[model samples]
Structure formats: C-alpha cells, structure tokens
Target: MSMGSCDINALKLMKKGSVPGMDMAGTVMKCSTGMWKEGDRVCGMLLGGLSSTIVDKKMLDRYGMQGSCATYCRTQCDMICKVPETMPFEEACCMPCCMMMSFQAFNLKTWPYSNKSHEPILVLGAGTSLGLMTCQLGSMMGYKIMAVCEMTEMADVMSFGAEKTFDCNDPQIVEKIMKATQNALTMAMDCSSTDSSLAIAAKCMGSSGGTICCFPLMMMSAGGKTEELMTMDDDSKMETMMEKTMGINMHNIKIVRKLPTTMFGFDAEMMGCMFKPMPDETKHAHAFLKTFSTWMAEGKMKVLPSQMAQNQGMKNLILCMEECKSGGSKMMCKRLVCAMGETGPSV
Candidate 1:
C-alpha cells in the first residue's frame, strides 16, 4: 500500500484505532464475480485500508474509514483495475488517489487534445505527487505546463513535462510566472490550496481571466472573523476577501474546489462538514480508471518515484506514517510503500 495526503489527513483527524490507508496493490484472494479470480493482481482506492480486517464499501459508509495497509482487504470489484505484470506493486499503488485526482482535474476543464491548443497550465506545488501527475497528464494531452516547486524539484518536475518552472520560495514568483507567460496565463491547478497559493494563482491569470482548480476546501479569513464565516459557501464574503487578498477582480476568475471523495458516490465528511456526492463524477471516475488501466498495460503512463518502507508489518507502517507526518526532504515527490505479510521485498 502507498501513502498519500489523504492518509496524512486521516492521521490528524480520525478517531483512535481508525485505519489510515487509501491506496493498495496486491493479488485477489477471492471474488464472488467472474470478472476477477483468485490471484489476479490489482490495485485500487478506498476510504481506509490499514486495518487487519476486511474493509468494504459498507464499512466505509458506516464509519467513514477503511484502509488497505493490511495483509488482506476487500473492496467492490468495480473499484479495482488490473495492474500489468511489468509494473511493480509499489508503483501501481501510487495511482488510485493521486493520479485519479489529477485525471479528474483535467476532465473538469476542456481536454487539450480536443482543442489541440498548447495553452499553458500552471501547477502549484508541482513537487507533490498529485502535482507531478497533473503535469505529466497535462503534457500528455498537449498542454504546456508551468510549474511552481522547490528548487531541488525543478529538474524532476521538468522531466515530468513542465516546460517552465518557478521556485515557490521566490518572493517574486507571481510576477515571474506572469512575465514568462506574457501575462496571458489562463488555467492553473493549485495543489497547495493555501491562502498565499490561491492568491498567486488568481493574480497569474490573464486579463481575460480563467479557471483555478483547488484540491482542498478553501477557508480564508478576512479581518478577525470566525472560521465558520470563511468557507467558500459564504460567497459574498469569500469573494470580497479573495478579491482583496489576490488583488484582482473576482468576477473574471473562476475558483473551482473539487474533492476526490465525490468520485466514490458518497458524501465526504471533512473538518465537520458534509460534501454531497455527485453521481456524474463517479461515472467519470470509472471511465478514467478504465482508461488508466489501459495506459498502464500499454506502458504509456509513468509511475511516480517511490520509497519502500524499511520493514514490514503494522509497526513499520506506523513508523512510515510518522515519518510522512513529520515532513522532510525525503518525502518530497515520492510515495512511501509498505509491504504486508511476506508478499513483497523488504527495504
């Protein structure tokens, strides 16, 4: 199983003893449907996957947590996709959450292939797994990618398909991006979703404006207001504060907040709020998974760099989780995988 930002969030917010995994790659032990048989190699995503017991959709719906860090896990047949024999289980596990979210972001906008335009797409936090996936996918679709990342990650981000790169630490990052794009940048994906990142993305848009896709729920305060009044739901106040914060006209730029949970057809409860499910999103997600599986089989998709956990079992998994939570240079642009039982190699 591979760790992701969602798993990190689970560590911070979930109740005690709750499992914390969302991506998994392993062989099927049993199946009720003929579509999948015993020993078929597959990988998928679910709410929580780190437990010893089987975690299915029902458990996720009831407890809002299910994980795949266990030696065994159970998910709906439709949730999985076949992993090619050529791909390592560690690499395949990185796709379900991060890659799926990247695909959804591009699908939300017009596809670059359909238009055949080389318009630039800015990716903030390009060093992140999701950001790297977005850059690669956008480039594959023929869009020019402009990325913002740490200096150490610039080369890797470029190799993934970003044509231009800017240092996030640079005080003049917004100006640099604007200058490079001739102040005509139209589209962007903000992986960070922080207040400063959002402001920079808005300011970097062209005079005609464009869309900024944000991966997290936006909560920005104006003055000393309470947190409740800062949600995106409060459009009037949000727009006013955003306009002031970003130093741009809010009417021109469209801010889109998309959560990956919608793809599962379940209301996502986060930070004490419930997000309704969108069936259409689930349909799109299935389609993308099918296409991605094909891509994997054809060796068209490149997997992200991964680090295997030092040991195996739940103790090692907990250590890996803590390392991820602590945050360091070692975790950047890499997925941490923990092998369960004796199935895979021990790092």
Candidate 2:
C-alpha cells in the first residue's frame, strides 16, 4: 500500500511540521502471499513521476514500510490514467495523472466564465509539473493563458499553450502582467503557493470577482491566501491597496486551495483531510481518464516533457526530489522518470 514515488508538495508540508496523509497509491508487492510474482510490476506515482511503474519485488523490499509510505507506492501502471503506450516510458509517466488532478481541481461546475475564450488565466510557477499541466488543460478548455515562471521558461510554457510568460522575480511583474493581459485576467492559480507568488497573482486578477487556486492546502486554508497576505483577509484592509494598484475588489477575491487527490475520495482519512470525495467523484475521475486517454491516442492532448535517469533507475528517486528542489529553470516544465526493472512499463 506504500507508494514508490514522493509528491513534492507533501514533502513541503512534512517540512512545515504538518504530516501529509495522501499523495500516494497502494501496491501489494510486500504481502507475504506475494501477490506479485518475480516478473510482476506495480503502478504508482513518484514524487516526480505522477505516472510510473516499478518492479513488485524491489518496490516491496525497498518502499513498503510505514515510515516511507507517504513518499512511495507500488502499482501495475495498467489503468487508463497512465500515459500513452506509444511514448517513451520516462516522458509519459508523470503527466497523465497530474493532468487529471489539474482538470479535477478546476471544478468546471464552479467556472463562471460565460465564454472561456474571453478569460485569461495567470498560472504561477508555470514551470512546475502541475503548472505545465494546468496550462495545457486551460488551453484545452479554451482559455488564453498567462503563465508566470522564470523568463527562461517562456518558450516551453508557450508551447504548452500559454499566450504569455512572465518572470516571477521581476520587481515590476504585476505591471507587466496587467499590460500583457490588458487587465482581462479574471482567474489565476498560484501553483507555487508562496507569498510573493500569490501577491503577484492577486495583482493580476481583474477588478471583478474571480477565483485564484493554490495547492497542498488544508480544508480551512482553501478559502484564502495564507497569512502571508496579512490582514488582506479583511476585504476592507485589502481594498485600498488592491483597488488603487491593481483595480481589484478586495472583497471579490476568492481563494480556492486546491487539494486534487482527496477531492477524488482518495484516502481522505490517511491523507488527514476533512472532506471525502462525493459519490460522484470517482465517476468523474474515470470519465476524465477515459476522455484523456482518447485525446492522447488521437494526438490532441500533449504529454509534458520528462527526463529519464536511465542509468540509475529507482536508486535515483532521491536525486529526482533534489532536482525538484534545486534544479531551477533547468528542471522547469518537465517530469523526471527512473525505470524499475527490465521493462514492463504497461505500454
């Protein structure tokens, strides 16, 4: 039941003294019965490869323990959520499920756009795996995108569907974004989940009420920016600042903390979340997988780029995590993959 991969967001929470309970998939390779034979494989997500496979025996021997459970899992990688079989195993494994999570988080039911084409969304951390997928999905949904990341990521983010890319570290970032979007930006997702990133996103959101999404949040924190926004939670306090500078209605800002996995009823209890996926959540997830697979097969949707640590295999997983932390622009907009055994990558 442990995962063979780790989720970077969960790792962040662990660093903050909060225990993360989800962001994992279950594999039974370790059971005494050995449901897995010598050649069998398990499917799961790595912190870097949201889509991946691993050898049952090795996965069991290495990651199947309570202490390491949150960071790794074992799986067969046979489900519809996996990447297209035709693509290289390393590049395809991380995007499928991550795409699904990004799609699910959008909750089309709550989307207020009358015509998606007219709305432009600002995606912070556009170089991260989640941001890359969000850009693709938003494009698919017909929204013009303004992605925020390092200037070096502009070309890559544009290929993924961003209309414009801004350097997040720019002191005049807000001014640049407003000009780029012509102040039409109505929604945003701060995939970076940092104070400065959220502030920039807030500045880009138009004066009218709009939604801004962030990730890896507790149920309660979902409603607004983290304390870094300061007393801005009080609409009156933020009104003067946001209104004069960004033309935003302080009271109109709606912060939606995105908890992608648990929204699908994926181990809420163990993940330490309050809400369970509604009965219809699974139906929707499956629907997404089915539709996503078809789109992939038809060459409509794109799989985010990924890197293979081919020589190292599972032993290199730790390196993948470190890459996420320090890889910077070089690591932007791509996933990292490591093979498990001889082959058997579900394709």
Candidate 3:
C-alpha cells in the first residue's frame, strides 16, 4: 500500500480506529464472483484501506469494501483491475488513486478532449503523484503542459510531458507562466488545492477566463483567515469566496473541486471522515475503471516511481506512513510500499 493525500486527510479527520491506506496491489487469494479467480494479480483503491476488521457495518454496506493495507483485504470485483504481468505490485498500487483522479479531472465536459489544440494547461504541484500523472495524461492528450513544481522535480515534470516547468518557490511563478503561455492560458489543474495554489491558478488564466479543476473541497472564509471544508453544493460559494480573497475577477474563472471518493461512487464526509454511496457516480466510475483496466493492460500508462521498503510487514507500514506524512526528501516524488506477512521477493 502507498500513502496519498486522501489517506493523510483520513488520518486527520476519520474516527480514531479508522485505517489509513487507500491504494494496494496483490494477488487474489479468493473470489466469490467468476470475474476473477485465485492467483490473479490486481490493484484497487478503497476508503479505509488499512484495516481488515469492519469498524462500521453501515459504511461496509454502502461501499462493500475494506482497507487494503493488511496482509489480506477484500474488495468488490468492479473496484479492481488486473495488473499487467510485467508491472510490479509496488508500481501498480500507485495507479488506482492518483491516475483515476487525473482521469476524472480530464473527464470533465469543459475539457477539450477531442481537439488536440495543444492549449496550455497549468499543473500546480506538478511534483505530486496526482500532478505528475496529470502532466503525462495531458501531454498524451495533446495539451501543452505548464508544470509548476519544485526545482528538484522540474526535470522529471518535463519528462512526464510538461512543455515548460516553473519552480513553485519562484516568487514570480505566475508572471513566468503568463509570459510562457503568452497570456493564453485558460485551463489549470491544482493538485495542491491550497489558497496559494488556487490564487496562482486564477492569476494565470487568460482574459476570456477558464476553469480550474482542483482536488479537495475547500473554501476560504470571508476574512481570508482560514480554510473551511465544504460539500459539493458549496462549490459556487467557494468560487466566489476565493475570487474575493485573492482579488481576482470571479466572473470568468470557474472553480471545480472534486474528491477521488466520488470516482468510486461514494461521497466523503466533511474533511473525508466517512463515505456514502452515490448511484450516479458509481455507474460512471465503473465505466471508467473498465477503460482504465484496458489502458493498463495495453501499457498505455506509466506508473509513478516507487520504492519497496526494506523491512516489509504490517508494523513497518506505520513507519512508511510516518515517513510519507513528514514529506522528507527521501519520500519526495516516490511512493513507499511494504509487503505484509511472508510475501516473496516479487513484492
């Protein structure tokens, strides 16, 4: 299992006993459905992925799944995809969450999917797992990727398909992006979803304005003093509040906040504490997952860089999680994987 921002948020907001992981890859031990059989390799994403025990039957009834960090975890057939024989479990685990999130961002109707116009698309936090995936996907789809990442990650970001890269530490980042895009930048994906990142995306938009697709549902308070977690219904209010706080014209700029849980057809609680099934999103996600599975099999996607931890076991999983949460150089631009039980050298 690998840690992601959603897992971090879960640790902060979920109940005390809730599990922490969201992504995992392993061989199937058993299956009730004929869709998959034993010995098949698969990877999946699910809320509360660190526990085998059911903490909430209500949640289980709604999601029909459990955390995947344990030695053995169960998941619905539809929620998982077969891993390519050549792909490592560590790398396959990184896809379900990050790649799918990027897919959802691009799946928007407003996005110019069919037209390979090469329009500039700004990717804030381009160093992040999700941001890197977005850069690759955007570039593969023929968009001009303007990546904003740390100085250390600039090269890797560009290699992922970014046309230009800017240091997030640069005080003149917005100016640089504007100059690079020639003021024609109208689309952006904010993987950071912070006040600063949001403001930067808004300022980089062209005069005709554009849409900013961001992860995490956040709204700025009237005083611009704090961030408030919001629901889907509050998206309009968040857009208005962000514009007011950042002093950007809101009329043309649109803010769309999406949660990865929604991709699985579940609505997360405020701050991502819990989830409830949503019929419409569930159907959409199932269709997407089928296509995603085919893409993985055809080698149409590149997995993010990952390192399998030397000490492999459940206990070491905690240590890996701590290292990821601390955001140190060792874990930057990498996913950490830990094997449970007597997993072989294959893991």
Candidate 4:
C-alpha cells in the first residue's frame, strides 16, 4: 500500500507512541516503523498510510460488488463511500475520493447550510470527478444543481442531474448563472480550486448569502505566518483576497474549510491523539457504507460516467497518471480506472 505524506507521517508518529496519526509535514521524517512483512499487500486510504489491514477476500468481494474499491473498508479508511454495481471499475475506484467527499460536502453535519427541494445549489468544476459526484449526490438529496463546466461538457453535466449547466469559460457566465438561479444560491461548493471560479461562486450567490466550502490550507496565502499548526491570522492576506476577488461582505458569507479526515467526524482531540483509532470512526463508517450501498442498489443514485483505460496491469499506472495529468476534453469529468491483471475495458 502507498499512502500520502499525511498518512505516512501518522505511521511514523504511531511508532513514537503517539496516536495512529495526525497531519504533519512529510519531507522531514525518516520512517523507522517495521510494520511490513516480506510479502504483505497493503490497503489504506492513500498509497502508504498507517490506516491499513491486509487485503482479504471479504474486502475484495465488497470491491467486486461495488465495481470499485474506494469504500471497500471504511472502518480503516477516512472517506465515506460505496459504489454502484453498474459503475465501471475505473469509475468505482474513484468513488471514495470523488463521490463520497461530495456527499459529505452536502451533509447537514459537515455543511451547515440547509437544503430544500426548491432551492438550487452551485457546483464549480462540474467537469471534475468530485464535481460530477457533487452534482449526482446533490440531485439525489433533492436540490437542483447549477453546474459550471466547459461548454462542450454542458450536455454531459446536465445528464448527470444538473437542472442547468453553464460554461465557466463564458464571459457572461456570472450573469447567466444569476438568471438561472433567480439570483440566490443558498449553498455552493468550489472544486475548481481557482481564484476566478471561487470568485464567480461568490458573485452569483451574493443576493442571499450562503455557505461556501473549500480546502482549509487553501484559504491561507502561499506565503503567510506559519506555526506548529493551523491558526487564523488577522494580518494575513486571505481577507484581502476574499474582499477583492469575491466582493462579499465577510459577515454574510460563511467559509467552511475541510480536511480529508474531517468527514468521518474526528474531533480536534481525536485527530491530535496518538496510537489509537477515533472511538466513533467505525460506527460512522458502518452507517455511511450501509446507507450509500443501499442507495446504489436501489438506483436512486447513479455512478458518474467512466470508462476503463486500455491497460489493466499495475505497471501501466504511470502512463494512466500521465494521461490524467495532461488534461483534455476526453478526460474531463470522467474517472479512469486501471484494474490489475485485466486485459480490456470492463464497462
């Protein structure tokens, strides 16, 4: 198993008698934990994280049933998820990070905004995996979605549960979105992670202010004061960017910053501890897995469109990654699943 820097840091900390993990910088540590045996295959949230167990038949069965493996083991992973059996393997593989996170973004627990069947929600980067999930999940939750993506992708976006779709590249998009939503979006999300996209979200929803969500570390300027951990700085340039780019009065809009581990409901204390799982992690995982699995089985929620790549062997992953990174119209808003030891597209 390979884990991200955050997960690797947690493993290092675990060996030091700290909780299983807490977020930390990766380049600084020398991992000394001898947890791996000679031929053990690992499974965790990321490539090589502390949260792992041996990949067993039960897990493989779940992965096979869901047509993806992202939510195969919620008890040991951070994200919430389950995949549709009809979903292509390539797409199902992305369900945990893309679709599951999107679900959490709309959850009343994580997202403070209220949802009504009549109100519309805005989704930036609707062409992304996360964006596609947001559109599908938001639609299932009973909100009409106004998706922002490339003009070429508008039709595809609409098919994914968007009531309306707008091209982000269109100069008149803000006006178009305003007209579509009738000038008020009660809730919005920014998956694009760009200043211009986020600015548009702010402008379109200004009539009746609402909550906007984005990554936590992103709120800070590239160069700002740093301490042992995250802290709000009044002198920081974040406020300036918010005022100048977004043009919203700070009081009216609430910006919720999310971390990867947060959706599983770990509190500050649990996240900061060492050498133990959060007490509620298993229960949260079980509940989410059950609910989402049922939804997929019932056909209320459909998998985002995806197609398998030509390569199924592990060695071709680098090539697949290159294809994904070198973006194109074809790659937009789609999941590319590269299965192991398979010869052709499964879907």
What CA RMSD would you report for each candidate? Answer: 4.6, 8.1, 4.3, 10.4
lDDT of 3 by residue, 205-247 (tens): 9888888887752231111322552443466777777667667
Runs in model 3 deviating more than 4 A are 49-59, 109-113, 217-226, 229-233, 272-281, 328-332, 344-347
Candidate order, TM-score descending: 1, 3, 2, 4
> Distance (Å) between predicted and true CA of 24, model 2?
10
Candidate 2: what lDDT?
0.53
Q: C-alpha displacement of 347 in model 4, angstroms?
A: 22
Q: Which ten residues in a row have the lowest lDDT in candidate 2?
A: 46-55
Per-residue lDDT tens digits for candidate 2, residues 114-133, read 34455788888887667888
Error of 2 at 205 (Å): 1.7
TM-score of 3: 0.84
lDDT string, candidate 1, 4-104, tens digits: 55567545445655667777888888776777888788888766622212224464644333577677776667767889999988788887777777876
lDDT of 1 at 90: 77
Question: Is 1 or 2 the stronger prediction by lDDT?
Answer: 1
Tens-place lDDT digits, model 4, residues 80-160: 233344543343344544544465456454222335655789998787656777887788667888999988777777777
Question: Model 4: how far is 19 from its true place, Å?
Answer: 20
- Clash list (residue pairs), candidate 3: 49-67, 49-68
